[model samples]
Target: MVAISSPGIGSGLDINGLIGALMAAERLPLGVMNARKDELNTDLSAYGRLKGAISDFKSAMGSLGAIDKFSVNAASSSNDGVFTVGASSTAAPGSYSIDFSDNGTNQLAQAHRLTSLDFADTSSSIAATGTLRIDLGGNSFDVVIDASNDSLDGIKNAINSATDNTGVTATVITVDSGSRLLLSSDKTGAANSVTLSDVSGNVAATLGMTTVSAAQDAIFLLDGHQVTSASNTVTGAIEGVTIELNALGATGTTETLTVSRDIGAVQENVQAFVNAFNDLQGMIGYLSKGDLQGDNTLISIQSEMRNIFNTAPTGLGTSLQFLSEVGIKTTRTGELELDTSVLNEKLAEDFNGVAELFAHDDQGYAFRLEALADRQLAIDGIIDTREDGINARIDRIDAQIENFEYRLTLTEARYRAQFTALDGLLSSMQSTSNFLAQQLGSLPGSAAG
Candidate 1:
């Protein structure tokens, strides 16, 4: 509660007549108390943001446990030496050959051999009603051809729109002043084949090609085993990876390739952790730096807050200590620096140990540290306490003012009543004395006569 000095109306009142002096005495302490309360409120709010960010950072660490760091290299490629490449950490590493041939698996590659199709002549127009049929694996579809429009471009768009199952694509090429509709599978290997039927006007005649092409399966040399696939895409070939065919044919010779996890993503995770730690440190530093000469109450509370961070909570994991173990050293300027190469090497050697350091055993030191940081940073925890204290002080001052006002009112009323009675007694005494003196003087003269 606030304590104020006695006012002019009270028993212990300082009767300094100067208005400035009186105003200064009342306003200065109130301002200080209010300022201290505001500081607490600001600090508390900052704490809340920090706590949330820290919690999220910790949660992100927990999620990191599930990610697997991997390294892979090519075992082999097909005999046809010129090979396509696809090796993601999420993909299985094994030798695969994309072929346009038949096997037991669903074909990833679909081949369409164009026959007497309508886009044979350059200037010819086929109606939209005219249908172009292409077989995608066993499923076949008739595309509504747009011949009145440019047949060369329209054929590509039409085939693409007609089928969802057709992994292969279509195009029209003009050679020697003649247009031909060309359909090719988007995926590699034999399974991605398309066979075109039902055509009109010189398309095959222009190309000089015959016998519609059939779809073939993918052939892979899996761990030295010759495996054939009827599909261009394969899943679970290895865990956490999928393969999509980008090109066609088995080049005669096999090649070796290497695959690994994305290093950039791992680096980002490390940086996030570093940022969160720095934020926590900054918040603590701000609260600790208080004006010593000004009101010491705020300073005292801030000191206590600093102490909360400085002490180590028991039951926390030793692994979670950042300052000593991870090679994060403080400079003379009191800023942190990380030995990244060393840290990375340690992480590579024992990633589990790195994880253990950040994660506490259920309800361990790390968790406790997180909780402490949360409370210290939260607006309600710090600001609310200070504000409440200031308000209590102000209430006490108001009460004191009320008591002083009550006593002054009663004393003023009694003084007025006593002064009135004294005036009457004085008046009566003056009149009687005057009359007695005059009579005494007159009686002496009469006796002489």
Candidate 2:
């Protein structure tokens, strides 16, 4: 049955007044219902955004969940000038034996010597120079002095800046009132030689004589086997082992032993995955909670959010009910936590079994749970029903307003026509009265005459 509106007005309806009253009532419910629906829509949209964020978080965690690793051993240098991987020096300053029997030795290394040298003057009224010249592998560079034209301290500045260069660096050490410059080379070879030509005016030279020592290639033993390596650190000579020289000491006692990315990198990868998983749980908790001190809508959602991991996938055994199997768990306050140690233990114990756990039967627990969380846990979930109801209410309100408008329009038209006819009748009656008054006045004047 069609519903009838009960706006009071049977006989003489005021068109404008009736229309105005009906419109006011209709507008109120229409506006209110639509506003409520809009608010719900906004909420649903926010939920969608959060849901997407949650999905991204989960995917990120999944990506990190797997182990990742790369070896960090020093690179293998095919020859000199090529950077390679290996250990450094550990021995004290002393002599050692090296056999370059395979690669042989260069005569230039044996005969190399300094031709000319210059040291900056500190008190000659000119800025101290930090420049030094060195011939590395027959390649020469005008090594800038550590000191600059700006001050008398340029010599000290140059030494510190020579890192990752062709030559070594040294400074003067003081004993009592006497000081001498200690020089070190970047490489260990007969070719690695240094000579001083103009140290008389240099800062530390004024205190002592500058000496150029005979240079030789680094001599060391790999596994006690004599190996004459051109450079101090030998890389790829053995897998995952690198050697660095002891600058202040000899070779054996203090060689720098560097262990490459051996096997720990894989472990680090797994831990990274666990950390990412924890991060995702944190985001889920934040999105689901409302307040810092207490709970709200977001909190309720968080509390219920655990359903994503609480159930096992279909056809999979009940053993994989939660992330605890893989080391993720939820707390009473609705936070997700992970223990990487436990996870790593599980991975180490049964990697394939765990893989099957995530993909057991057809789709694994993680996959199914992720799908459910991404699709069903929020407002637009399979069982969740509120947005549609609100929208329907709004639509119903709109229809009622439309019906009210139609009724009011018809009533207004009928009333306007009826009132127009009544106005014509009143006008005719006033005209007739004026004519009768004129007739009566003329008859009375005739009697007086």
- Assess the local accuracy of residue 196 in candidate 2 as a C-alpha lDDT between 0 and 100: 42
Error of 2 at 44 (Å): 3.9
The TM-score leader among the candidates is: 1
> TM-score, each model?
0.46, 0.36
Off by over 4 Å in 2: 1-18, 26-29, 32-36, 64-308, 311-327, 339-365, 374-449
Model 1, runs deviating above 4 Å? 1-120, 123-132, 143-170, 186-189, 196-214, 227-235, 241-272, 287-349, 359-449
Residues 1-449, candidate 2, lDDT per residue (tens digit)? Answer: 99873332332335457556755664565576567666656556655555565566556435333222122123232322222334322222222222222233211122233211232433222333444544455654444543343222333345446564556554544455433345555665666565443322353333233445566765544445655555655545554345443332322232223333322444454455455445555655554452222424445545554554565655543344455776766678545566778666766676554555554533554454455455544566632444465466667767776786677667666665665565556556667888987788788455555
Candidate closest to the true structure, highest lDDT: 1
Q: Estimate, for each residue in 1-449, the C-alpha lDDT of model 1 and write its tens digit.
A: 89873334332223333333544554555556566556555644554444565566455444342323323223333322333345544554443433422333323444445443445564455433355566655567766554454355665676677645456566666776566666666544454455655564433233333446655565554444555555545555545444454443343433443344444455455565456556545654553463212444344444653453355434533344443365555567545567777667766776545545544443322344445545544666654465466566666656655665565556555554444455455556667888987788788566555
